[model samples]
Target: MSRTIPRTALLAALSLVTAAGATATVFGTSAGAATAGCKVEYQITNQWNNGFGANVIVTNTGDPVASWNVEWSYANGQQVTQGWNAAITQSGAAVSAKSLSYNGSLATGGSTSFGFNGSHDGTNAVPATFKLNGVTCNGATDPTTPPTTPPTTPPTTPPPTGGRADNPYAGAKVYVNPEWSAKAAAEPGGTRVSNQPTGVWLDRTAAIAGVNGGMGLRAHLDAALAQKGSGELVVQLVIYNLPGRDCSALASNGELGPTDIDKYKTQYIDPIAAILADPKYAGLRIVNTVELDSLPNLVTNVSGRPTATPNCDVMKANGNYVKGVGYALNKLGSIANVYNYLDAGHHGWLGWDDNFGASAEILKQAATAEGSTVANVQGFIVNTANFSALKEDHFSIDDSVGGTSVRQSKWVDWNRYTDELSYAQAMRTKLASLGFDSHIGMLIDTSRNGWGGAARPTAAGPLTTVDTYVNGGRYDRRIHLGNWCNQAGAGLGERPQAAPAAGIDAYVWMKPPGESDGASKEIPNNEGKGFDRMCDPTYTGNVRNGNSMSGALPNSPLAGQWFSAQFQELMKNAYPAL
Candidate 1:
């Protein structure tokens, strides 16, 4: 499993040192060119306990720069935990940010910006120096705003990676994916453009946070280690934000274009694998949910669902989705100490004939996509962030009891599986036949499916509606079973636990409950980004025969921001009761 990646592949990946421990700044050798036309501004946009976010805009006050690099230092012992947009790295107290290929060129008097989420001690002081292309800005001063410290809990030191092999995960500790929770924690709640007050519910959003593709993983790893004190650490990384991301969905659309598979490989996957291969993190157990919703959509509804797979037709037009995810599995699947769980759509989805075995077979193709065998794979993840029950206490995959027509029948779908557990076992069997290891396990997301209490039956009736009958015990009664916004009446599912069933390895909270699924279709956001129709209360796309309607879940913040009202609702309706 530890075979060397080709030299051509390792060339760039091996040199991507995106993070370094620095308490003090170490100046690097500068090219002696005079940089008179460059100017930069750093502003702290939002702050929370022990952390803050900053946006930096670079202006070419003079001539156009074919390329650019910005460097700064954090005084007062503040560490740049993680960042996005620009490729950021820290050495000692010094930090350097280079523009991505997309942001490298700036016309004269033009401006481009990048943002980052970072942490600081109680005393936050802006850097006194700024340099673009290694030349210092002339009239820059330290920011005057006082530093703030949000409420924080000290992290327990993470125990050795994976713990004892025989007792892997015996520490009973679930690692939070800080990659996301940290972002949600920073969202402002009041009625503001970036404010999403309900984000408080995601205080522990990531027992392990996912770091998306191409944003660089080194900084995230550094942040995770810093956040983990002296306890067992289980880190969850969601390898998402793919080019042509959310193929059909627009609300959670990603930055990379679908055609950029080359970038996805060299820039995204390679660098990600490099960071995870670090010797320092060898003792940390990492759970990698590879490309959430990427492959599954292509298998189930790429051409059919309008509300769910909005841009899928364009994606299918080009072959980026296939090449992109395949390369990801080939590279990341075989890493050491990394548990790669490929995302499989929830039960209701694969439960349909058009999906099941086809999805399983797709998983097989992806496992061996890049010259690697299925042995490169770990296992499969079912119901990732989707509101599907672990098991419908009322129905079975083979249950043929009720409903008028086959379309309205809950237990008459492909091979008759209605719950996540049965689907998972069946998938494991299918996967084994595809050459996966016998020990291959499945992860069921218990995040939002906890409709156990009153909402269990969720008014999903009228008997004629096959969806309602099949999903009778489900808390999610959205227009289409594919509705994935911040669902209404959703309660916390089973607490994070390992081995809940025969083929199921763990019940993880893959989706932080309070985070928004898409912007409220009501509010307007920035360009190249749009509100998910599913979040619109008035959305009517996923409905069938006026019976099922998509968008049952209301307006939400951007994909991962906190939703206050949703949090309250989740708490009010927690299943096992937190």
Candidate 2:
């Protein structure tokens, strides 16, 4: 065999020797083939979390490889909280990271994987540069940088603070009584009419029987909840009853005498306490006893006569009847949410000073007698009737009837209806001057405002008017507006026509949708005498008398339907996305 050795075999042997020598020079190993198999590559993937996690792909770039070690660094404020799948060690900001228990050797040109968690910020974060077995990896990218934080701005003028403002009427809520007579009749054990000298009739039983056992009460509550919606609206429930009782000092007809007062306490007031105590209606706040007392001692009309004797002196001397109401209010306060206000006639009816200051004094005395805190007394409610004329009433500015004359009058001018915007602003300014801007708020009856086809005022108009007068340096921001008497005819249909401005907090149904404003006898059909006649697409008659076309009976489904529709419309127009 030595004498005849093949040339091909000799060449193969020589080639093997040269490859071995080259491997020895590169790896310093006699096992050159084995050393050449150690080449590797690294890759990072899936970095995420509050910090970051990554899967590292390692491949044998030259030959088959066993285990490997990787290294990288992190910037300041960026610390790795936790990591997985790979062994990791951190020394300050630097990481001596490596794959742990990486099973099986990687084949040449084949890839293996590992993972880790890291921290980063928009500022100094950099993708970790990776290496395998003390050697840098090919095709390995650096860690990604994080995003930067934006800057914040401060407000120029701070919000008004301290009990809201000087205006106590601002943002005040108002509720209207729908069934005055019915509620009076429902007093428990019936109300007694001493008939003074004549033996007292057992009127208590019948009166108590008349109380609808919470039906009407619940309806009113429901009506309030429906309009108020959680805490969005400041809710006021005015309990108006005809023939309301008076402490011996202010008895009218024979009704609500001393005996009747006792019975009313046990029946009407007591039941109210029970209902309020129930958790189902815990949100009912502001229960005001709106007494239409036998007209103030000065007035003498068919409905104004005192059936008994004039007790103006007694009323003046001791505010007894007022106290009685306070007493009842105290009881209701124990079980229910309430804020009582004595009814103060409208500006047109009651001299401004008398209605505002004098009435406040009377309420103060009554509240004192009842042991109620000054806050409990609250303030007064100013209301207008159907017979009230725009020229005579300041609230007439909200009327919608069209005409050149209607546009000019200072009180009820159509253009001036736009003036309510100014009025609200002026009132806020006035309240602030009085130091009541923070505590008081005003409530406007918009029920009749939309009467005679007036469109509901846009929020921008009112806000602009208010801002022009108040925050614009011309007026104060204390006077807030509460839109009451919201009926279907109140331009709810044109709700989306304009954006609602601020200052007007709530639009409540002060006059429930269905109640009638008495028969049409007082007003003619042309004046929109009948209830449900105002907004009817077909009703083309002129407003007769001055009857509101919006007042309908409370129990009617049509009224409820209209109310539901108007509410939806108001929400759409006033608070679309909120």
Candidate 3:
């Protein structure tokens, strides 16, 4: 399934049983015409030193709260550092949390919850007052403060493994979405996995990605840990939700604003890091794919994205992109088992001079932000949620053809590179020049690079379509690299493997092949589901609707969910005969 959507239906079940062991503090219900049937329950999910993690479920017992807003005040000088599923603001002792766009409409008698990470002095007490809209609760309970402070032990940050034996992952283990797997199994041409895959996806789209996703991630880890025998447990997480995210596309927009860098760190990364850092999970190896479109949009921003908050420009100006990623790498990297890979745009992106050096500089800056060098990072990823061909089969970096000396083409730079393989090789060298260690390798998302069958390009030369020319295929399958939905004619690339090429560590199906990119236009279910017009077949044009998609897939499920047609097509067209 696409990494864009969360399995929300499983959120509640997952959250209730996560490793943090939450404690729900119930409040007395107020009954009156003026009160609005509002009752809130506060749960302290986790605490350590001066910081704490919490969950708040606000219940509307009386009437529907369309576009609801919840306001509360801190009692003992505790301040909310970051929050999710709620837009929280704190002024001294008072804190107010407004409902996010996705969770504002809570039905009567129904409840929705939000989560956060906060800090306090020696005394941290839960607030006694809560107001839904403007009405105060009848009998709200307050939490007690601890009398004594305990010394906090600093967690160990392991040095990078110098030998192959010290590496946590013996081989690359690709995560499979259990929910998507089941959906695929139920399809017409079903295939159920005999052994459960090692990784699981945690989405951070809108407010839902944080609130409901925690439980899902916990459950996935719990299950994987339970069955893990001699093999190391691997979990793949997508750190996707960024402000102005996918600015170039409409289907996978995020809830955050470009400038909310502090919030992004506190609200988004903290909670996820907390889960990973839990002592119980220390035995497992976790691979975090940080911020998919963050760096990439910046690359595109340098050319063509002449907007005020060109996704990358805004992130750079506010320093959120680097800061957020740095915080994640440092916080999660501090955990010996957790591996962080920053998203380096696909080969198609970094292939040009306009894009190359800039991406490497960003990587260096991020390392600086994390208070470390590039060598500390696990590596960078390419072709994430993209359909760029894995390798340029017939052409080398110096091959000359098609009116330009490979140097003048939009796909090649003056540096004499023409394909993704060359791009990654050159990318490794650039990063090394900037202080990345020689051992630092590259990873490719071999999920859907297999653009084969009738649409696979057969003939070469004078190939105007950049994808076909680079891919060594005559009929390029994707509408554009920007076309991220359930693409037509695109198939699964190579399965997970170690050391696919020199300087390349692994080939992974990072984007699960069969999952729908999003719902198609002319079909609708939920907000941001099915029918973005970008996925509409009738609208023949570039992903932004200016050119034609050569072999586009039909409208399908919500992004991240399964689409039977897309799955079958992928298996049918898989490269290396999956």
Candidate 4:
């Protein structure tokens, strides 16, 4: 939605390890202002045939800095491939990792970590030295201590029976829905990513049983048992049938009316919670993505906000959204094997000053409502079914073009954070401050947000104008930040993985890549879905999208239905291209 008011910038404060290409750039390495001293710890976490993952933690031992960068050289012919939490670039044996907008500050003795996946032919030795802001650190790999070999596959302690693991996704295989897999494989080149794990959306009461002969919750969990095969497996269930769901967008409105809180609790959540609590499925780690786009609507779309909507005002007044989400969390979270992750709107929807803190407080209110507490929530998920980029390499909120801040750019529109990773991590910190568990993890739905086709920018845009600086270099190619339909030039992002960053639990494909966001034009259907102009490419604009073109793909099918054209486009533009 359009957030027109010019507000003060709020910088991010957390760490997230993300993927990036290997290119050489010199920004905050040798050119950076000097720091007193530092210490670096580099360790190989996992290894494979020809590739491995490394975690680097840097401690600033000197004066405090608003931002910092670390530099090092590889002894072997190692190549840095993908990284997160920091903007990394590599050339020959030398590499530089610069802090992002969130994790830049190092308050003398403060430490932050980022990780990357790299490749090596035979030897993958640790870097002997590291420099922070141009000053050499005390050590890289400790000289006194010998480096221990790491295991090839990530180790796993099988999830304890009838208990929650620190991270359910860790050392676990995510369940793949055969139904979606078959649909994807039926496409021309969909077989490439067809087997990827995506959430099984239970959007209505009929879906809880079986919608039109489709697999129900029990069937999926039973299939997960087959997939378990002695190892842990995560079954992702999207608990999405909230009353007046997605009030800000008509495309994904629910079957229940605004006041049907009781129907949502009994017919929808109770049945699903019963099935999950069954001992037969207790071995499987059940992850419920509870209520997508539900709570944030109460904060951003309610009365008195710039982007207020009548539908949202009604939902807020009735308090059903909060009551429904709270009841769902309490019921589902009570099961030891089930982990409930509430949906936190993406950065584009809630990264502004007015929306950010207020949204977190609203979440706290919901968590405590209906006899639920913060402990019921395992974590929070962000960027679900939206096209916010995971990270923006070219421009930061702190960057200025001709003395004009990038936050002032048309696309950024005074938003504090640039991308989803920073927003999720910062949001986690904010949630913990509001009495939620400090260790609660964050999940970023990476499906269809890659923006990594030929149009993907390689380096920083020219400094001629703030707009050019952000628009040219941004990985998200949508015309406006609020465009959330089947967007043009969108791509599949990083495949699902666990513990990829500091506070993140995983990068999940919770939103199946093949399903349409909404129909491009009005089409009647038995499903409760309604056509929203944001999905129509021909629609010129809305206040939510800065009154700009919708930037949607044409000829799209109804939401949750297969749009083969959009599926093919996602695969064609997928990052880490197939």
Candidate 5:
């Protein structure tokens, strides 16, 4: 009654078919003839870029030489765009493949192999109903043909059409950083150096006040309210400064000491609790307390630079800090969305297996110490300061090293950064296989990877293709856009028209725009110099120029501008209904 094929026959069928198609079978074995047995073996390998490669092995156990056919079905909105190795002929959701060239006469213990490449957005599964030489196989008395039905499409909702009714966050209130602002300033002519530090710091009160008092905050709330009908667009406040103000700061260079922990609780942790306690922003969803580490040494530093260790002790203490913070946030008893994520190094940096395992262990320990379980700790953020293969290679961790060793073989190459589609797809597959499928997500720094910063020197036409891949494709779901270094450049405008591919989610500006990296010590108008100038607009010249002239600094304001622009664009593309 059950329809099943033998494993050996399946492999032989697939192998013979693959060989006939000019594609090699990476892993598989042949079984006996298909007449006597009913076992099946198949694998989906090299899933990347909305496409995947598959290998199916089948065995025949009954009689002598005879022709055969294999059938299968796919779920989860999966569709076969193109295939190789075996001859694939599809009718709606039902796909059938056959061996054109048989491997001589099959004995009772013969086997065959077949495989092909496919494209899909959801789950992958094997189909039922197979036949050999017109004889219904798998011992099924009745082999009913699958029905032909067109794939279903997602629903479309219109944008906001009314008043406070249109406002997504009608009663919801949010706190903002008063210091936030964005703008570029003139620079003196010289060899410019980037002033953007490698880390982020936040003044809790200032951030909360800015959000509570500004029109920008209202705009964010409005946008969220608009999208509320679709799904919860929980407003998040990222407090990155912990232990140090910035990555390059002297204090940050030191390991996280007890003093750092104590100060963090008083200055940062307590204020967060106070904000959550307030009734106005009671419905707030604090998605994550992201610790943005800009320095390369944040993880494992081969350069021997000083790094902050977020070990078990620090994390445990921080857990108590968060628990206390959570208690305060729950004052309204309506704040149920607060969560935390430790910034894990980028894919290239974490490598694979051992390196990733070690970092994961540290995270697990920290989460446990925090008095929270791994479930409470959201996935790690994979980001980098410099968006290039050269910079990403500094921390490349792959699966090349044996499973028992710290290293494993390299699953991805940093050189693919320019290949946005390939890069995003590869990461999706790699992450899923590593158990981060559901929890892990990526935040891409759209600022520099496209045509800004160091990429300027290597610019080769617009990164429009890459943008489309990240924002207009199915693979963009796990990706969140961040303008890491936003002095100026291309890729800064609105989101494209087409909704991101099936799996792609919303886009947001992780990095606030306009903030300066620092002042130009060498060249004028460089990112470092731009950041410095923006921070203190009037302060001209370079670091050589003493910190004089005072107005609001650039970091906060510039960030606001970028954030506003990105949000608007997101509404345009993904949330037109909002």
Candidate 6:
């Protein structure tokens, strides 16, 4: 689930939904002969007792520039606390934001955006005027057009309150992303599950607005509203993009450095919180699946473990993962309708007796860091963006062959649990013991774990040896439990359903079925993703998989990017086949 891109955090289509209604001050020069002009849209997205959130979009209406800057003054005595997508600074009543390395350029007709959180003394008003590159912006129309009226006032939605439901998805219809749906429906026989709800991954700060013309947070929330129509609807969002994310994996390496925790907070999480906190989205249930493969790596891939790596060791020592997750939980959980679910690694990774208890404790540690508590977490999700089977109907974890325990089998590999369901149930129990709420629930990512096909075993294996017995019956057909990539035999798992099992809130397709795990070979891109040998079909193996050949599909694309081949494979091998 790690895909890195140094994309600008542009706040597009966000002015329409704010707490106290938006005040758009479209600015351009009045001079008819102007050759260099700009239009700035200043909006107060969220306002509170003593603080507020603002988004500014700067459009270049004149000549192009290598870089640009926007300056404005606040009528009220406001102090900027944090900002993103630009370098913001305040001196007295004047505040200025300069372009950053990635988002500086502004061509004619091009636009970019930035947002910030500020503290005010009650009266917060939008600035009357703005300046771009030291030129004052005065008129509503550009040089070519006659003067015109500004856009109408934004919708007047009442500020949301802290009245969260006990279970956000209990009686709600989950939102199906039209973007993902269209992609699925175009594929052959994809209409069967094309409408299934998948997590909207806000992988970078740019995603808070929109990335590559895709739907931004506000647009998705607005879409969710249209889909609501009266009955409750749950919008699942994956809040990824921690500094040094997925340290154990190369393919998913993130853009933020190990110490860029501040950037993660301000640039990534803050704007998302601002958008979700908007009153227009109050009625919709927002479920945030917190950072995946992060906390677990702090447990299974740090120094002292045989599978440990230097990058993981750096993350463990730096403690940014703990700080970042805690901060995100604190901010997003504060929103009444937002349910925060931390990502717990799958059974194959953490089911070992030594790893299970330790992983949960570390999560508890992260949950309590940076002013966050266990209360911030509504639940936990497992097997996200992975191919672990939801259930093994044939053999049991307690089963043995010729007096040999399944735990001794090569596939089981001394793990305490054999499948996701059993491991999730056990993890929930373990979490409860560590001061998590007794009512806390679990979610298993059945997205790619179905393993249904003609190759699937219909019955138990021969009682010859432990390895033979477990391998013959196990639904997950990977060479090793740790061989996570574009797995060749993986299939679509269960469709999203609320309360599918006891102590489980839902079985979800958190990772959409069609997306790739990683590229099979190195491909260059601006997105920070790297080529991991684990995704290469010819890769022999690593310590994590006990030197087994990588069971990955050939010619895969970058992680998170759609791969048509993988999508077809998933639908073809789907359990309850399409």
User: Which lDDT tens digits does candidate 4 get at residues 463-566?
Assistant: 78998888888989998999999999899998888888889999999999879999988889877799999998989897899899999999999999988898
Q: Backbone collision count in every prediction?
A: 34, 54, 14, 5, 107, 1
TM-score ranking from best candidate downward: 4, 6, 3, 1, 5, 2
lDDT of 1 at 268: 66
Output candidate 3 Cα RMSD.
14.9
**For residues 192-265, could you state the per-residue lDDT of candidate 1 as single tens digits?**
11211111111111211333333234555554454444544556667775678776567766667778778777
TM-score per prediction, in order, is 0.62, 0.36, 0.63, 0.73, 0.38, 0.73
Residue 234 shift from truth in candidate 4, angstroms: 0.1
The true-versus-predicted C-alpha distance at residue 11 of model 6, in Å, is 42
Q: Looking at model 5, report the run of 10 residues with the lowest lDDT sum.
A: 182-191
Per-candidate RMSD, Å: 14.7, 28.0, 14.9, 19.9, 25.1, 13.8
Selected candidate, larger lDDT, 1 vs 4 = 4
Ranking by lDDT: 6, 4, 3, 1, 5, 2
In terms of TM-score, which candidate is stronger, 1 or 5?
Answer: 1
Residue runs of model 4 more than 4 Å from their true location after superposition? 1-153, 157-162
Per-residue C-alpha lDDT of model 6 across residues 1-578, encoded as one tens digit per residue: 22222212121222233434454545576475488788876655445567766666687888898898898887779998766667899999999999877568888877776766678886675666789987777754211111111111222223223466555666677876766764665455664676678999888778888876567888778666655645667899999899998998889888888999999999999999999999989888899999999898988888888988899899999999999999999999888888999999999999999999999999999999999999899899999999999889888878888888888998888899989999999999999999998878898898899898888899888788988888888888989999999999888988777777789888888998888889999999776788999999999998989999999999999988888899988988889676
For model 1, the local distance difference test gives 0.59
Q: For candidate 3, write residues 280-327 as lDDT tens digits.
A: 887677777877766655555644543324545656566766776777
State residue 437's C-alpha deviation in candidate 2, in Å: 9.7
lDDT of 3: 0.60
RMSD of 1: 14.7
Strongest candidate by lDDT: 6
State residue 147's C-alpha deviation in candidate 6, in Å.
50
lDDT of 5 at 569: 27
lDDT, candidate 2, 1-578, per-residue tens: 02322434433333343210111101111133434332221211222223433333344555565665656565545565444434678888767656445334556555444433455563333322445565543231212211111011112122133222222222332322323211211222111100000000112223323322322445445433433332322334444322233222111122343334555556556665565566756654543434533223223111233322344444434444565566655665454344444443333333333233444445445445565544443333333211121122222333322332333332221222232333443333443344332433333333233322223222222223422322222110111111122323332111111112233322223433223333322233322122434333233323221232333212222211223343332233221111
lDDT of 6: 0.81
- lDDT of residue 550 for candidate 1: 57
Which candidate number would show the highest TM-score if scored against the true structure? 4
